[model samples]
Target: MRLPILLLTLALPLLSQGQTADDIVKRYLDKIDGSKKWKDVKSMITKGEYDYGGIVFPFTTYAKAPSQYKFVVPFNGKYYAQGYDGNSGWKIDAFKNETTPTLLNGSQARAMANEADVELEIPFINYKAKGHQIKLEGRDTLDGKQFYIITLLKSGGEKETYYFHSTTYSLYLKKSIAKNIELEKALLDT
Candidate 1:
């Protein structure tokens, strides 16, 4: 989904040298979310496309504070839905002949649960309190542009690497790899 306001705030500058991970994170957050507007958001609805392989599906996402989220996508004349109610994670895969909500378990469940909790605020905000660790992994270049690499180690041991534009200080890309699980869990659970 498009974050219109945050996208418009990407003009901030980055640290020059000897910047710690925390310092970089603070500046990044301040630039894009200085007003802390997300704190006042109790709920949100985002409509977008879900790209699967080379195909795409139109989807609508519903999120409410304190851990509630749902997304529905229509495919082949049927609607498929997945969500986490305040208590449990569930999904209905119409293609699999599952028309009713089925409780999720294992990594899938934990991933969804974690997503509901984190989506209320921007990622990296209070990351230590969230049991995540960050490190400045030096710099890297992608397509001729310089970027600062910051890696986040999740409590679950999942690793996510964020690429921030060196000059603009905007997030350019994020890459993640599951430490143990077969499927890599996404930071946004996207």
Candidate 2:
């Protein structure tokens, strides 16, 4: 009798915790800015600093219709530019070695390049819950508030696992897997 009661006590809290994480993901999708505003935008210009492997690089991107885009990265007193402006793709290096009319064939690379228009809309899109595998991993206190862990899996093989503030439903961290690189490489080679 004692064992049965103990199991019930432990299970009740686990069930509630899973529900809390699911609620947080739902609220976050409905309220975030990126998901809503970016989906409809046709063109944009963005300037920011990209930090990779502890090195900071100044970057700028411009996008237009029909797969037109320009990306510039400045590092160590030089600038590198790459783009596809409707007709063809091109690159200009620090030494001014120009490569124009270069074909960009990899699906993953093209998808990544095209994603500039969609990234800002992530917060506002209505993500259909095909299914959910929720777990109450653990809790962390940050800036005097606590957060819950939630993982969401979409039917299309895209996964997002995020940490949401318990009180605000605001996300602190999110991980997603998009596009398959092996298939992309094979496409590029052909």
Q: Compose the digit string of candidate 1's lDDT tens values, residues 1-190.
A: 4677566555333326677788778778877884377678788886655445446566667888878888787878887787888888888888778877888889878866765563666568778887999999998899999988999987778777888887777877766432212124212322
Taking the tens digit of each residue's C-alpha lDDT, what string does model 2 give over 1-190?
Answer: 9999999999987775655654666676666653455567777776655444455556676876546677677777777776766655555666365444344556634653543323333432454543435555667776777877666565444555567787677877654432323122111100
Clashing pairs in 2: 34-121, 34-122, 34-123, 35-121, 35-122, 35-123, 35-124, 35-125, 36-124
Global lDDT for candidate 1?
0.71
TM-score of structure candidate 2: 0.48
CA lDDT for candidate 2: 0.57
TM-score of each: 0.61, 0.48
Cα RMSD of predicted structure 2: 8.5
